[model samples]
Target: MSSNGSVVPRVTTRTLQKMRDNDDPITMLTAYDYPMARLLDQAGVDVLLVGDSMGMVVQGHDTTLPVTMDQMIYHAEMVGRATDRAMVVVDLPFPEGQIGIERSIEAGVRVLKDTRCHAVKLEGGAEQADRIAAMVTAGIPVMAHVGLRPQNIHVDGGYRLQRDTDRLVADARAAEQAGAFAVLIECVPSSVAAAITDAVKVPTIGIGAGSAVSGQVLVTHDILGLTTGYTPKFTRNFAEIGKAIGQAAADYVAQVKSGGFPSKSESFS
Candidate 1:
């Protein structure tokens, strides 16, 4: 049973594969802290990613490049500790896994050992096949990210939609062949995402990549309307939680100023 007191099966890499095989959609959400991880897990989210996007969402950085391995490990540890069933996967922060095969393997090993996360996710496609293969060979389960990789935000100029059908399909196939248990496709057209999903044997998790893929992921803040500043085109605020929080705070302030908060029964004395 999970923290919610329900007997849902614990989600794992094999669970994700089974979902794909059975044509069941996988649900993923990004979580960086203990409270959020606990909530999402209890709500039965299948996977919780401690994504490097924490650089932007949590640390107030412009891009994910500034996130470090130490920061990732710290956050991953919190999420892993809080989660009872949802599989936790931490990102290999920029330049960590991209450097070399040995470095990549070392980073993956450290993430799994230190955080006790189920797996690690890395960005790149065919070019990253060697690193993915090496990590899997070393016993690290890898989830590959292709299409609009946020790690390449600077190089790509911005979060533009990926349209190259042949390349996207090839990347997905190569990652699967390289032993990645699943692949994440980001910011691509639905047609292209669908093709790639068909091309790969493993599950394809999409973010801004449309509905034809096997699964979907979104940053929790983005979906909850908690994100400030600019919101992405692909994001939909499922709940106005930020507004509700602000309204609650405003109500509390008004009650305190009017001396209406601690009257009669509200007093402990």
Candidate 2:
């Protein structure tokens, strides 16, 4: 609980591990700006990720590859300012952590210092262990991303489910061994996701994986039905907010044109 008497406790790496141990499912959502971060924090989300997906969802980019570290830091700082309890994790962005171990550490440090986020999330698994290790050794908490990495979208052709159970399990294990506090399992078969979750000591957060993992996450825009086109099959729209917003605007315009709005009560005395 905070000084404001909020029931939501502050989320941290240790808190996430404890949640996994207790069989409590964690909740995470992406927020690239302050308003969304404030709403998610108020709703008691366990984690708020400033994901590189913002490149597509917010900036209208075709891929996350073009998202720069400076853009991530700018958005992350806004999220950090709005959130008080949820653990904030920002993506290190493409090529930032993939350049080399030294470059990875530099990126991680810059992200933490500039954004005030709790940790930096980088895409990769066994192949990224050395970089992950170096970042952790530099005192930067890292959240490892395994399975389908968006940073590798061009190489992989497109987003596809990872079916190699053995590879998934090995990647998760390697990340844990490399000192990643948690691993995000994305776009993998349910069986593979479950296998990795079971094989890893650290908490596994799944996106389009399944319920058997430690937790689940989704892009906030997708969940709220704010995304305009090509929604993923795994994404579930919980609300028709986009339609509602459009309807509200139409109603306001009609009322104003008909001189039915800003009636006596809305007028100044």
**TM-score versus the correct structure, for each prediction:** 0.94, 0.94
How high a TM-score does candidate 2 get? 0.94
- For model 2, residues 106-135, the per-residue Cα lDDT tens digits are 888888887768899989999999988889
Clash pairs, candidate 1, are: none
Single out the weakest 10-residue window by summed lDDT for candidate 1: 1-10
What is the C-alpha local distance difference test score of candidate 2?
Answer: 0.91
Candidate 1 C-alpha error for residue 236, in Å: 1.7
Give per-residue CA lDDT, model 1, range 135-231, as digits (tens).
Answer: 9999999999999998998899887999999998888888999999999999999999999998888999999989999999999999999999998
Candidate 1 deviation (Cα RMSD)? 1.7
Which numbered prediction scores highest in lDDT against the true structure?
Answer: 1
